[model samples]
Target: MDTVVQERLSTKIQKAVRKTMKYIVDEHDVRARRFLPRNDLESILNKKRLEQLFRELLSNEYASDTATAIPTGSDTGSAEGHDSSIEIDSAVDTCVKATIGTGNVSRRALLALFLYQPHTRLLSLYVEWLTSGHPRIRKPSYDDHEIPCDKSIPFTEGDLETLNIPFTNHGYIMDYQTIFTPMTIRKFTHHDFKTRDRLPFLGAKEKIKDGSSGTVYKTNIAPGHWEFKTSDGRFLPENPDTSMVVALKIFKTIEGPWGTRDAKEVETDFNIERELLDSLRKRNISHRMIMLHWGSFSVRDADGIPSYHALIFELATFSLEAFLKDEECYRIFTDKSPVLAGLVDIVEALHCLHEHLGFFHLDIKPENILVFVEPESVHSGSNHEEGRKLIWKLSDFGLAREKGSTRERTGHRLSSSYYSSQPSTLPATRPAGLYQAPEIQSSSSSQAGPGSDVWSMGCVILMVLASIIEGPEGVTDLSSKLEVFFLNAAGKQKLFYVRNDSHSW
Candidate 1:
């Protein structure tokens, strides 16, 4: 008897739910077609009308009709029980789910109904019910409403990561209402670098090198003659009055080996370089290091996405590698003293890096060591002083690691001269005979540390000194000399002796 009554009640409830939804579709659903926001459509439907519709559908007359249509306690067989279940299923199918699945009602329109009346728990419950795959709720098609897109800023998922905000993934469009602002959206546009009001001049630039990560440009930051220091321990302005040439390293705004262009990577590079520079600023040892002005900034590309980071550095005359390759530059080698002096300054920078900053310059090579040209004293200085006067400083900390940090292999191609023998989890990629420490070569599990840097530095110094002593032959035979030192028994003894003697010196 109770089963019969419950079936009759369920049938009536399904009918009421269908009628209520149809009325809502007819009235509120009309405004949705005009592309009004979900809130406005709900306001048009109003709370009073929604409650009134439910009230009308559950009236006493409907209950009386439901009770009269099904006789209770009159049938008692398996066939009768099966027939009642079929009737209830049919009612739910034809009546309860008739509106949502088989109609032209947009998913946006239906979703909007739930999103309205924000403080209510109904929205969350409605979403749960809709997704539950209940027999009475049909799966609705969501293709009717086109997502509104901002054509001006066509940023991708990667580009949007630059904002550093949390967002929900909804296909191509993001749904982060609480986090996004008008200012944030404007940042996604490419209008920042065009102004001469704040940013430094990037025009009339000579392109230096365009690499996978960033582009480097040679630009004049100011106009004047410049020197790293004056004789009296005061720092000189970088030729602020006349042709202050500097190197501008601009990070790639788009297209870097797929994931390399992500904002996190860009931010990591920015923070690491900025913080490292910040920690090193104004120290007495900074004189021996690459001079990076606090002028670090960011810029958006044409697509309104932050594409690159801009940092201003004191321009190196050329790399030490370039200095060696020059035939004319080698004329100043009166002995090994010039190479030794430059090596001392580079070692000092490394000392500061290791002892003071707790950092290890993982990538150390002749190319990473920049040679700063000092202006001649206008009185035609002697070759001896000038030869030993070449200032060498460390640059390119892109692969640098703090001391005690685990070694992770980088994507950069290693020069044979610069490769360090550290056990890297990354495969031995592009291996050729070169200058890695014995520990690195013998075991793939050995980690890189300060000693690894010392080894690389020694190799660089050896090559430079060898080139000077052996004249043209050392530069040409650099590859063979490196191989002999790392591979030959006699060369190893000579290397050990040099290492011991260097500590005494």
Candidate 2:
């Protein structure tokens, strides 16, 4: 039900954001300034990087989702029927699900209302979302939407033991499910330093392997680990110990005077990217969906150069493209799920994000996703066992936007980074155009809202489904046509997918 509701909610938000973008642009254009952002995402991506992103996004859809993914309740007590038996199925593509009643939400809502006066309004929003969805709920408050208990709920867990994730003593899935069960529902467990501050490391940084994100410095605390990233997005910091990371950024004070609005656009982009990543995590959709994991922040300076930046996730493996085409991938890898399952999972992830999270994965091609090449055999949620669950993570969040937050109406709706190369015979697509919602191109940008993400997701789907359809020569054209329908209003409203004859999925 949550997933279903999420899809509807994400769609509404997308529409709303696009609508808001039009309003902002219309108002701003009176001064004769460009209303929409310019195209730029792909031009910056080199051949190697583009290839890598294309592959990773399609790799086994991340460790957290592929193996034993389960949705835990929002309540403090054990979810109803935690021990009850559920009907087992034999299909690998289908999911196993059972309704045990809405859990902690009933209580989580009550507690949120009482503890935070501002959140009481959320009850109304949730109720509306629960019943009517985004369009019906005109006034929604982003201020207090967090779950009150870390505010995230566990997604579907396929097979717990397969993932090697830990379980609580009472036999509950630990990380995927609520950390505290229904019985433990206290209003203020988040405030307990012991719980929030407990570092989630299993080994020392010196002993643990550091992937692309680069060098991890061990802290004095036993087994505590921190990865250092320099100002440049890459991992080349000499010593990240003295770095200073900022929260709500404070303006720089210059000797002359304060800078103008234009001066702050860079900072705004940086903060927006960071906050956007944080927002993704807060939504419980997995940080991999938008960018590399943003873990901790710190300062480090060993040489004379002072590098200030964020402490983000250490990738388990290179991106899906490199891992796939780079000869190195074969030496260290094993395979299990049929190619079909891999394609299915990527579509599933994109679908969930588009339909549930309310944003666009602007770059839907294969290179942006990452496939972890870890060792160890694990069972998939479908009762199939494979060696080392593939962890396909999402990356490169620079171009993401909230639902309905597009600016097409003022005629400058194109995104930056979509085009940089000199155009060939067939002109290259603008970044916004690469994933542009065909319907929205004709309609107002504001009306395009969530469907833009749907359009991008469709491009991704076309890419992945290419692997399934027959005949390599004509696959691209056929897949594009097939997927274009998926983005149409009739498709979304009726929930149609001709291939599966699935109207509600």
**Overall lDDT per candidate, in order of appearance:** 0.46, 0.34
Measured over all alpha carbons after superposition, the RMSD of each candidate to the real structure, in angstroms, is: 24.0, 29.3
Best by TM-score: 1
Residue 23 accuracy (lDDT) in model 2: 30
Model 1 segments more than 4 A misplaced:
1-204, 207-213, 222-241, 253-260, 282-287, 290-294, 301-304, 332-336, 376-388, 404-446, 480-505
- Listed per model in order, the count of residue pairs whose N, CA or C atoms clash below 3 Å is 12, 72
Model 2 stretches astray by more than 4 angstroms:
1-263, 284-292, 296-311, 327-339, 377-386, 404-448, 465-505
lDDT by residue (196-218, candidate 2, tens digit) is 12222212232222212123333
